[model samples]
Target: METAIKVENLCKSYGSINAVSNVNISVDRGKVYGLLGANGAGKTTTIECILGTKNFDSGTVLILGMNPQKERKVLFERVGVQFQESHYQEKITVAELCNVTQSLYKNPLDYTELLKQFGLFDKLKSPVNELSGGQKQRMFIVLALIPNPEVVFLDELTTGLDSRARRDVWKCLSNLKAKGLTILLTSHFMDEVEALCDKICILKKGTPIFYGTVGEAISCSPFEKFEDAYLWYTDEEGSENESV
Candidate 1:
């Protein structure tokens, strides 16, 4: 159980509002950590802080035992990131993108095999802008995994795809974790979290309202379903704290 990521009292503010406040999070290696939060709940802000893409106003963030803010280059080598929204040059073929990303890493995985695994083999010669939304999403996912990174970040990964496509992505993600890749994902989809996550951290208004295994979160809440449990927790916080 190596600690792949750690945070203590993490805070980020946007002028008069605190997007993330005194957040403490820790993710062990080789497990899927689902960050469950609604829009504007600071889930993205917290993720950005962890990846060193955004500077926090205060507190500490460590990824792979290195300070993310100060050791970004060192941290990136072992990290794969798939942003919530991703795109590429219109004329760039999928295979070209894969090859370019592969060249950036010292030891990349087999690009062709990865593309095949994600059902993007036929789209290899297709331009990114010409592919269907699902195909494009698969392309981005393949790009992320091609580096054979130790940890991966997937933010709202299944948004535009249909049910089958989303399930395919989930299968790919599951396989990555089986290969001992630590994954941290943020999603508003409770069912997705329940199906894919080993543990979950429920956030409301820039703070952790609950942190535990998926089963634990469900068991501790007085609700019939996970979605109900989430609403119950956040609604309670909203009523009690007002600002939250």
Candidate 2:
């Protein structure tokens, strides 16, 4: 299988505090890789380092066989990232925002079609801040896809959305998956992980407890349910050294 994203011994520190330590990940093309962890497990930090948005203490990161730090311009053209938190101009309309984002790319995707796909077509005239939470999330995703990226990073994609809204986004993502778009996402929701991830890396206290298929992770744990198994990997009393 073709590797899309690879990180070897990725480490990051904030003076005395290590945000991530010896983290390793490898994602195959057209597959979803979930980064599972609690709020302070270094999920976001790891992603930021891999994306070259933040400097890392040590590690090698490659996206589509190109180094993210040294070849950021070329690498980013084929990558899309939707951060956990995003700030947009409050007064920008969906169309206007999409138009602006589209201008940045050499060969942008059809934003109008993307808006339609995400069910934001009717909100073309609606201001970004005026949209509902779910709609806003969908809009962000739409903007990310404007680049026609080969790999997309979604942090907490469905965090605050209602069940139906989350499912809606999942359905849209499933469609993209069908078209062979690779995805890397971080999430606390096991259901989302189950629905999207083909493989995962579970982090605990800035360290990786496990990295492999979901079934492998569960088999390594004492529990059958993914949520229980995830907790098993994160809990201090649980076996953090076990991996598949």
Candidate 3:
């Protein structure tokens, strides 16, 4: 299988503090890969380094067989990203935002169709800041899909949604994966991880303690359930010095 993203010996630091250690991850084409970690475990830092949004102290990063930093303009055409925290003009209507995003792509998908699929069609005329939290999230997702990208980086895509809405988003993303889109996401919800992730890398203090399928993770830990195994893997008191 082709690799959509690769990171090797990735390291990042802030002065004397190590924000991320030598983390390595590879995402195959058409797979859903999750980066799991508790708060301050460097999940976001690793992703930022991989995406070329932040510089690293050492390592190699590649996306779609190209160097992200060297071919950023070309990479932008093929990669979609939805940040954990997004900001825009307070009065920018959803429709306007959608139009602007689609304009950046060479052959964009229909933003309206994407919006309708996410149940955000009626809010096109509403200002982004005025929409509810879930609506804003759906809108960001819609914008990400507008690029018709081959790979997507979603930072906590389902964070603010109710169960029904989160499941709806999952269904949509699963469909995208079926059509051969590679997704890399960070999430805290175990159900969300189990439902969408094909493989996961659980990080502890910026180092990966587990990297494999959910079943393998369950077998590695003392728990039979994926959620329990995940908790076991991430708990600081359990495996602070362990790496797998």
| Ten-residue region with minimum lDDT total, candidate 1 | 235-244
Clash pairs for candidate 1: none
Over the stretch 58-128, how does candidate 3's per-residue lDDT look in tens digits? 98999999998899999989999888887677789999999999999898999999999999999989989
lDDT by residue for model 2 (1-244), tens: 9999999999999999989999999999999999989899999999999999999988899999998889988888888889988779868888899999999888889999998888889999999999888888888888889999999999888877888878888998888888989999999899999989999999887999799989998899899999998887788654534532
User: Model 3: runs farther than 4 Å from truth?
Assistant: 240-244
Q: Evaluated with TM-score, which candidate comes out highest?
A: 3
For model 3, state the Cα shift of residue 4 in Å: 0.7
TM-score of each: 0.93, 0.94, 0.96
lDDT of each: 0.85, 0.90, 0.91
Quality of model 3 by C-alpha lDDT: 0.91
lDDT of 2 at 243: 39
lDDT by residue for model 1 over 164-231, one digit each (tens)? 88888888888878988999998877888988998888888888889898788878989869999888
Task: List ranges where model 1 is wrong by over 4 Å.
Answer: 236-244
Question: Which scores greater on TM-score, model 2 or model 3?
Answer: 3
- Residue 231's lDDT in candidate 2: 85
Candidate 3: residue pairs that collide: none
| Number of the top-ranking candidate, with lDDT as the measure | 3
Candidate numbers, best TM-score first, in rank order = 3, 2, 1
